[model samples]
Target chain A: QQQVKQSPQSLIVQKGGISIINCAYENTAFDYFPWYQQFPGKGPALLIAIRPDVSEKKEGRFTISFNKSAKQFSLHIMDSQPGDSATYFCAPYRDNAGNMLTFGGGTRLMVKP
Target chain B: NAGVTQTPKFRVLKTGQSMTLLCAQDMNHEYMYWYRQDPGMGLRLIHYSVGEGTTAKGEVPDGYNVSRLKKQNFLLGLESAAPSQTSVYFCASRSNREGQGALGRANVLTFGAGSRLTVL
Candidate 1:
């Protein structure tokens, strides 16, 4: 995809471990970077979001770290548990005339208890 | 609040068949989008509507078409389904009620549960 490049197609983590997924984009016009979480047979839901102006944003146990100059952003999940196992995707949005979203391939994370 | 609802949770179609996916939102969002999710390819945009009576192509709009006759409804139609078109379809809506209005950082997207379709 020409939009964003995501890493680690699949990841396995022990209970209470940390899960990390990284995504990089080439479009400087992208202003909103958000991560979506999807469980089996479910639609992807917004997990966290960040604006280009902020370097990092943390909510609950999820944190989004953005590097504007590097055009990269990553999602970090702390104290990951089995219930946290799900697929994560990085989608960046550009609000020009309308909202245009480009998503990464996705990362499937399995947290084993 | 029934943020977004997609009809037909699952469907199976033979090659050359046709189907339509419906997405309805109660949030009164101005922007609605249809995306197909395939393995490895992730989620690819099929079509989008900025507002009622407006539709635009996305990255993978070649195999699909869309219509937004009402502010809360967006419809996706597959004229002739192909085997390669088998994938999970998602509908999303965002209220552009954030930031400078034109370019807002708070454009939050709410996604539908999803509609699974198979074209064999």
Candidate 2:
């Protein structure tokens, strides 16, 4: 079963525009949500994360909005730049087993200059 | 610290062949993971290790075997190469912790560059 589902296989946005990616999960046991950014030929790095206890969490230009009832979460990037172009993955953590993570399909975002 | 690293950045294998992918982490992490990435399937967990000498199956563990002989090393072996197993593989490690803001909560996964395998 696919625990987490992400939409928009690929996306393009103009520079300085807002970029949004959505994700949904079926497992309600997950409490922690995190987003990762990956560049070509490199590993993915932590971008932003949020706990279900909070409705939203923002860090600089990156924001993660969570809806516990809907079992969905989203990542929004404000004032996106070309440098922000990369693959983004949304992952949820299940506490049942050694804090294992369930990752989404992933979304590739491209910011046009 | 080198964090997490994988050997054989790129490899080509023939059907029925056998090979092993090595992953090493120097951070003394308690949790280790192996994931495979495909075009649209995203990253699927093949196997994982909670600690040294412990291994567990994940989402797609078929035709794959893993070993965590040493705390710093994790190995993934394919007994018989198949075209379906051709994909990019990643290794991750995280420290152990408890409660909120703990050391490792699955939010931060230090991954390697990834090993690209091709089976023909």
Candidate 3:
């Protein structure tokens, strides 16, 4: 069973357009929600994250809108650029002694020039 | 600053072969993790360590073992490689220091380049 589910396995967007990816998680105990971006030949890097307390969080063109009651969250990229093309993953974090992240399947995004 | 570093970026092995993948972090993080990325399966944790000399299993720990002998190092070992084990492995580390930096949720996870292993 998938605790965290992400949709749109792949996406295509034009430069300066808006791109969106959605995810839904079943674990209410998740302490934090973070998104990761990965390019070929490189490891995933933290993009942006949000706490369940907040309805939304935005950083530059990357925005994370979270709905606590619905158990859903989505990432929106405004003015998407070609450089933004990469794989995005939604990860819900858990902590024991240290933080552990559980990732969704993944969404590959392509920004067309 | 070499946030996280993985050694033997790529490796190939046959069934029954044994090898170890090394992970090192310079951020002085207390938590280190080993995860495998398989197509369509996302990234699944294999094992993890909270501090030096401690190790614990994750979702997929059947064919792997891990050890954290030093504060900055975590090692994942495959006792007997199988074709099913072929995938990209990632090592990551994180500190508890949050609510700092530009993002309120600071001290986030830092990942290595990755180690790609192929088993035949």
What fraction of native interface contacts is shared by candidate 2?
0.41
Candidate 3 residue spans exceeding 4 A from truth:
A95-100, B98-103
Against the reference, the lDDT scores of all candidates come to 0.87, 0.87, 0.87
- Per-residue lDDT tens digits for candidate 2, residues B43-66, read 889999988999988999999999
Over A12-104, each residue of candidate 3 has an lDDT whose tens digit, in order, gives 999999999999998778667789999887899989998777789999999999898899999999999999999999987653336446688
Q: Candidate 3 lDDT, tens digit per residue, B11-83?
A: 9999999999999999899889899998767788888888899888888999899999999999999999999
TM-scores, all models, native as reference: 0.92, 0.92, 0.92
Winner by DockQ: 3
> What shift in Å separates residue A19 of candidate 1 from its native position after superposition?
1.3
Q: Model 3 in CAPRI terms: which quality? A: medium
Q: Cα lDDT for residue A74, model 1?
A: 98
Spell out the clash pairs found in candidate 1: none
- DockQ (C-alpha based) per candidate is 0.47, 0.49, 0.54
Give each candidate's interface RMSD in Å.
3.3, 3.4, 3.0
